[model samples]
Target: MNSAANSRMIEIVHVNRTFQRADGQMVKAVDNVSVVIKEGEFVCLVGPSGCGKTTLLQMVAGLLEPSDGGIAVAGREISGPGRERGMVFQKDSVFPWMRVIDNVEYGLKCRGVPAAQRREIARTYLERVGLGHVEKAWPRELSGGMLKRVAIATVFANGSRVLLLDEPFGALDYVTRHQLQSVLLDLWDEGGAAARRTVLFVTHDVDEALSLADRILVFHSGHLVDDLAVTAERPRSTDSLLLPDMVAIKHKLLAHLGLEKRAKPLAIVQDGAAS
Candidate 1:
C-alpha cells in the first residue's frame, strides 16, 4: 500500500507467445503486449474467448514459456513455476484422492509444515470460504461449486503474493457463479483492510469483470486493446449496472469483445424505441 501506482509488481514486456500445431503451422496465441499490475490491485482480464488471456496468465504463473519477450515478478524474471504466484484453472485442480481438508493443506504439506499446524490453517481457510462443514468430504462427494470454493481457498491460504485465476467460474451455474464471485472479493479484501494480494482474474463475462475489478484490462485477438478503471464503491450492487456511468463502461468493454446491443424490432418496441 505504500507504493505508488507506477510501482509495478508484475511486468509484461513486449511479450509474445506462439504455438505450433501438429500440421506445422504456427499460431500466434499472444501478440506483442506489455502492461504492469500494481501491488494489491485487483484486475480482471476481459475479452472474447481465444484472445490469449489465459495464455498470458499461464506465462505469469511460469506454466508456459513465452515464445518471445519476457515476464517478471518482483524485479526478477519468471522462467519457471514458483510458490510466489498461485494459479487456479477452469478445471478443478483439487486432488480427487485427497479429502477436502487434505487438498486444502496440500501446498503446506509440500512445504513441510507440521501436520497439526497445517490442518488448522487449512481448516481455517476452508471455513472462511464456507467449506468448514465439509472438510471431511472427498472431492467426488462435493458439487462443482463446492470444488471451486475449495480450490480458491487453497490458493488464498498458500499466502502467494499474486493470485491468477483463469475463467474459474466459467462452468458454474448462474447462482453459484454469483456466490463465488462475492466469495472471491471477500477473500481478496481480508476484512476491509488493504487487499492482501494482487489478483489477475480472467473471465469472458463483462458483468463479472464489472462486479469485482478495481481495473479491467481489455484484450482482443491477442492484443492489449483497452484498459479501464472501475471506480464504483465496494460491496457493489448489481443494480448499479443501470447507472449511466456503469452502462457506458459495459458498452465499452463489450465493444472490445466484438459485441453490441441489439435493437428490438419495430413491432416489438413501443414507437420504434426501446421501452
Candidate 2:
C-alpha cells in the first residue's frame, strides 16, 4: 500500500442531521460530530437505541444527507450512494425472488461487469462465507443466519472500499451471532492491509463491540461522547473479557450508556446489551 492509501479514509466534519416529527418539531438526530477513520480500520459505533448511531452510519453510506457539514471517503465528499461504499441493514436484505447466487451477483451485474467475471467473483465470496452449496437456493429456503451470509457476500463481491453495517446481527440468536461474527472477522482479515475494506459497524451490544472493533465510538443523545481504543488482543474470548483491563473498558462503556451508576460484576455486564 502507498502512503496515500494509509492516510485518513473517512473524514466527518461537524456533521449535523435533523428530522421533523409529526407534531412539527424538528429533531436533531446527529449533532455537531467530527471523526477521522484510518484506512483498513474496523470500527464500531456503540450506543443505546435512537442515540444516532444508525443515523450517522446512513450519512456515511450516503443513503441520507446531512443538514450541514460534510463527509468524505478517500478524499471526495459523498453526494449519494456510490459503488465505493456498500451497506447492509438489520432487516433481511436478500431479494426473495432471486436465487442465492443471483443475489450475491446483483451488485456486479448492475455495474455491468462481464457475466463470466462477475459470476466468478460472486462464487468466490459465497464460498468464503460458507454459502457455496446454497447458490441455487431461494431466500425462503435459507435460515436467518444464512441470509446474512448472502448479504455479506454481496457487499464484498461488489468490491466496496468502505463497508457500513447497521446492526446486521442484532436479531440473531447468541450462538449464531457469534458464529457470524467469526465469519465476518475472517473475511475482513483475509488479505493485506491495503486490500482490506474500512468497516463501520453499529451495535448496542458492548460485548459485540469489544469483540470486533479495533476502536469503539460511544454516542449518546445525538452526541459523540467518547472514543476509546480497545487494546485487547484479537479473537477476544469470554475469559479474556473478564481480565481487569477489559473489565475496566466495559465499565467505561457502561457508564456512557448510563448503566454504571453502581458498579456491578463483569458477569452482569456481559449478560446483555445496554438498554
Candidate 3:
C-alpha cells in the first residue's frame, strides 16, 4: 500500500444528526456514526431508503451539520462546503443556461483560475468523459446520460481531493448506469495510486457498492451497521459477485435490507438435453 492509502483522510467521530418533524417529533437521521476513511480510498455508504446513508454523506460534504460530534477531512473539521470536496447528486446538476464547456469550467472560474488555463482544463476533462465534441452544446440539448457526463467532468475539472457522489447514476437506465460506472472508475483510476482522490459514494444498490468500493459501510435505521473490507482486485465484473467472499458480503448486506436471495430451481433435463 502507498503512503497516501495509509493516511487518514476523513474522520467521523460519534456523529449524530437529527431533524424535527412538522408533527412535533424529532427523528434521528444519523445516530452516533463513526468511521475513518484513508486518503485515496473508495468507500461506499449503502442502506435502504430513509436509512440515513445520504444524510451521513451530506454531513461529510458539508451540506448538512451533525447535531453532535464532528467530521474532519484531512484533519480539519468541516463546518460547511469547501473546495477540498465536490459533490454530485442524483439529480442533474448541469446548468441548462450554460454550454457544456462552460459548465465544466464554472468551478474553476469561481476559484479564479485563469480563463485560458481553466478552459484548457475543462476541455481536457470533457474529452476524458467523451464529451469533447459537445463542448458548445447547451445542457437542454444533451441527453440525460450526456448531461450526467457533463456534471462528472465539471467536478473533476475543479480538482477536489474528495468526491461525494450521492447515487449519481441512479436515475439512468441499466446500460447507461453501467457505462457511467465505468466512466467514473476510469477517471478515478486515471490519476494513478499516488494521485487518487478519496471517494465516498452513497448508493442503495448492493451491486453498485460491490463493484466500486474498497470498503463498504452499511447503515440501518440511522446507525452504522457493518464495515466490510473488499480485498477483491480491481477491474471487477458481474462475475466478481459470484466469488465466495463477495457472495457472503452480499448476503449480509441483503439481510440488513430485510431481503434474502432465493435459490434458483434446477431445470429438468432428459438424456443431457432440455425436456
lDDT of 1 by residue, 118-222 (tens): 999999999999999999998999999999999999987787889999999999999999999989888998756455688899999899999888889887778
lDDT of 1 at 133: 97
Best-fitting candidate, measured by TM-score?
2
lDDT, candidate 2, 105-199, per-residue tens: 99999999998999999999999999999999999999999999999999999999899999999999999999999999898989865577899
Angstrom error of the Cα, residue 249, model 2: value is 1.1
| Model 3 spans with C-alpha error above 4 angstroms | 1-6, 261-275
RMSD to the true structure for each prediction, in A, is 8.1, 5.7, 9.7
| Candidates in descending lDDT order | 2, 3, 1
After the best TM-score superposition of candidate 1, give how far the Cα of residue 244 lies from its true spot, in angstroms. Answer: 2.0
Q: Rate the local accuracy (lDDT) of all candidates.
A: 0.85, 0.88, 0.88
Cα shift from native, residue 245, model 3 (Å)? 0.9
TM-score of 2: 0.93
If ranked by TM-score, best first, what sequence of candidates would result? Answer: 2, 3, 1
